[model samples]
Target: MMKIVADENIPLLHNFFSDIGPIETFPGRELNAQNVGDADILLVRSVTNVDEGLLKNSNVKFVGTCTIGMDHIDTEYLQQNNIAFASAPGCNATSVVEYVVSALSSLTESNGLNLEKIRVGVVGCGNVGSRVVETLKRLGIDVCCNDPLIDQTGLVSFDEILSCDVITLHTPLTKDGPYPTHHMFNDEVLSRLKEEQILINTGRGAVVDGRALKHKLQKQPSFTAVLDVWESEPAIDIELANLVTIGTPHIAGYSLDGKVAGTEMIYQAMCRHFGLPSRHKAAQFIPSPPLSKLYFTSEAELSWSMHTAIRACYDVRHDHYALMSSLSGTEVQRSQAFDQLRKSYRPRREFSTIKVLLKNTDSSMHSQFKALGFNVKSA
Candidate 1:
């Protein structure tokens, strides 16, 4: 039997891959050369650093990460050593999009601002960003997109995106290249943000300079910031955490559906690489959602009904409060708490899992709900 090493935090590992081989589990951050030395396959999340240091003496032939981002893995080294690797791209795109919508709903409600009147600027047009743009547009919300790499006509400039009512980032972290994103929002760019503008980052933490952001928030105080990712994460700045409107341990993509989908994607890849018959599917492994159905009457306001339904499925405030309450000790303690929150994250299903029953609703509203990935039923 083949030996497999996997991150303990990854969901549905045993259910899907246990039939293939005996799987050894470890905390992603604690995975080292010694622990993975004799394994034939290694599976991990973003917390593990997969490099030559960890695999130099290992017999690991295949590596996979059940996460969207790949910054934690050294692809160059893996390629040089003839190790096959795979990452689940776009698996969590819907989850992140739902997070942005939930945050915006809470932000607008608290501030007494009209959602339709706000212009949202999406900074990256990849898998996650494109979904955000599509969802916002379907709701009659104005959205401007900025992605230099994509060749779509009428792409907005970066400067135009900066001046929008809300700015959300979904770009990867790149430090040294033609279009580097590391510190993309430096002091100069951050200074340009108006008091009315709200900034939300669900992308990589280092994309924005954390120290600069903290200092700017200290001076401005009126600038609204919603941060799900931070620089030097796990040890993220406490002051910045306090300053942000909504702060969360990096778990925007922790939805049970998304995590299971990621695992399934990588599992199929591994099975194909080894020419084994793949027998697992994500839908079969997903458990019943906490909120399975919501009913809306004819008198229900479209915006209110939508907001209530989305929040019912997964509310962002629960996570925000959890992070705020966890960071009450020394830096190391806070760091441990941050990781613990992620490890013990509760099961959250996506919009599609919940069915919305609408009475006397128009075709437009029904179409909108369907477009947002909701199961819509007319009564």
Candidate 2:
């Protein structure tokens, strides 16, 4: 059997790759050359930094990250060493989209704001942002999209995005190149935000300056912020976490479906690299969700019913609560707790997993629910 070293948090690894390999699991951050020395396959998440130093002495012929972002992986080193690398792009996109929707529903409900009335600005129009734009428009939300890489007609400028009622970021973290996203939202951009405007960051933490955000929240009381990914993640800024309206430990793309999809993506890639027949599928390992279906009453309001169904499958508040409880120790302890929380995160199902049966609802209502990614059916 092939020798494989993989990150421990990657779900269903053995189920997918066991027939081909003997897998040894390690914490992503702690996965060093020593752990990968004798392995022909190395799999990791965004936490592990793949570089020459780590792989120069190892037998790792293939490297894969089960996450969308590639900033953590050194593609140059892999190219130079002839080590094949694969990353699961858009694997967890729907999960992130659902996270934003849940946060939107939860935030709007708490703040007494109407979802359809608000204009949301999505910074990146890639896999995740595109889905967000489509979903929001399905709900009749006014949306503005900005992507430096893509030149589409509907794309708006970043300045235009600044004026939106809610700004959701989905850009990747890049330091070099023409369009750098590191510290994209500094004091100047943050100062432009209004007191009541909502800011949600599920893209990357450093995309918005943490210190600047903290200062902004401190000086401006009512400026609402929702953060899932932080700048110096694991070792995140606790003060900033406390200031945000909702804080989750980089789990926006952590739905069980998403993670499994990611694993399957890389598994297929590895199989292709080795010229092996792919025998396993992700759906085979996935079972029915705990929340199978939801019933709507004749008296249920459209918006209220939508929010109820969304929250029943996923509530950002639950993640926020879990994260808040882990924030009580020293910086080191808190940092460790943050990573632990992500590793042992509860299995969250996607919006599509929950079946919504509508009663006495219009066609538009059913269509909207489907657009929002729920498995909707007329009762």
Candidate 3:
């Protein structure tokens, strides 16, 4: 029988594939070759680096990642090591896009920010950014795009992105490229931003300089920010987290449907490559309880309803802000603060988790969510 070892973060794998082979589960950090010993196939998330260091003397022949991003995997190394690897791409694009749009709608309503006339710029028009652009355009918003790699395939320039009313980044963390985004938005670049514009980054964390953003936030007074990913991950900049309009612990792609889809893709890939039968099934997604009838029908009511819904799922901004505010004096203490909060973060409901509830105002809205595979129920 083939030996298989899977990362703990991957859900519902054992029950789906237990009869396929002898399987073992370990924490992501414990997936290094030394720990897994003689496993023939290794399944991972983005956490376990599948580089030479972790697999030098291992017997692992096949590697599969349950994630959209392959930046964590060393493709060149895997190719040289004769390791066949696969990743589930575009699986969580819709999930993440929905998260960004819903969050934006909530932020604007709560903070009274106007989106009607706002010029939105999206960087890196890949799976996630492309969906975001399409959805925003569907909502009748002005949108621009920037991606040099895609520019070779007929994309716009970054200079045009700088002029937008709101900028949202979705590029990968590349340090050396024609359009290197590692620390791309630093102090000098940030100085060029308009005073009233908003900035949102749901992509990689290091793409934006947190310290520089804090400096800009102080100097540029009128600017606002929404960060879902932070530099150094669980060890984020406390002061910057407190100042942003909305912040979250990189859970933008954590929708229930997305997770299941991503895992199923990987499972199917494994079965196909090994000539095993696929038994993956579509999971039944259910939405949250309906909200009480609105007392007043203002933007305030809509804002409050959205806030309650979002908070009911998970409120990363308020909770992280509170964590940082209550930190002890030392930098080490603050670092520990972020780690504790992140490690202890409760499960958040992704867009798929909330059954689609159309407020009866728009028949189009009902159709929209249904098209996106949501279980729509109109009030």
Worst 10 residues of 3 by lDDT: 291-300
Q: lDDT tens string, model 2, 1-379?
A: 7899999999999999899879999988899889899999999998898998789888889999999999888899999899999999999999999999999989877787788689999999999999899988988899989998997898988999999999999999999999999999999999999998999999988999999999999998678999999988889988988988899999999999999999999999999999999999998999889999999867888878888888889999999999999989798999899999998998899988888898888888888888988888888
TM-score of each: 0.98, 0.98, 0.83
Candidate 1, residue 91: lDDT: 91
7, model 1: CA deviation in Å?
0.7
Whole-model lDDT per candidate: 0.91, 0.92, 0.72
Rank all candidate structures by their lDDT, best first, as comma-separated numbers. 2, 1, 3
Residue 307 displacement in candidate 1 (angstroms): 1.4
Candidate 3 has an lDDT of 0.72
User: What is the TM-score of candidate 2?
Assistant: 0.98
For TM-score, candidate 1 versus 3, the one ahead is 1
Give the runs in model 3 whose Cα sits over 4 Å from its true position: 151-154, 282-347, 352-379
Candidate 1 lDDT by residue in tens digits, 1-379: 7899999998999998998889999989899999999999999998899999999989999999999999889999999999999999999999999999889878867766688789999999999999999999988899999999889986799999998999999998888778999999999999999987899999999999998889889999888899999988799899999998899999998899999999999999999999999998987878899888888888888878778887888889999999999879999999999999999999989999989999998887798788778999987
Give one digit per residue, the lDDT tens place, for model 3 in 222-319: 68788878887556777777777777666677665566677788888888888888875646332342432222122234435444554544444554
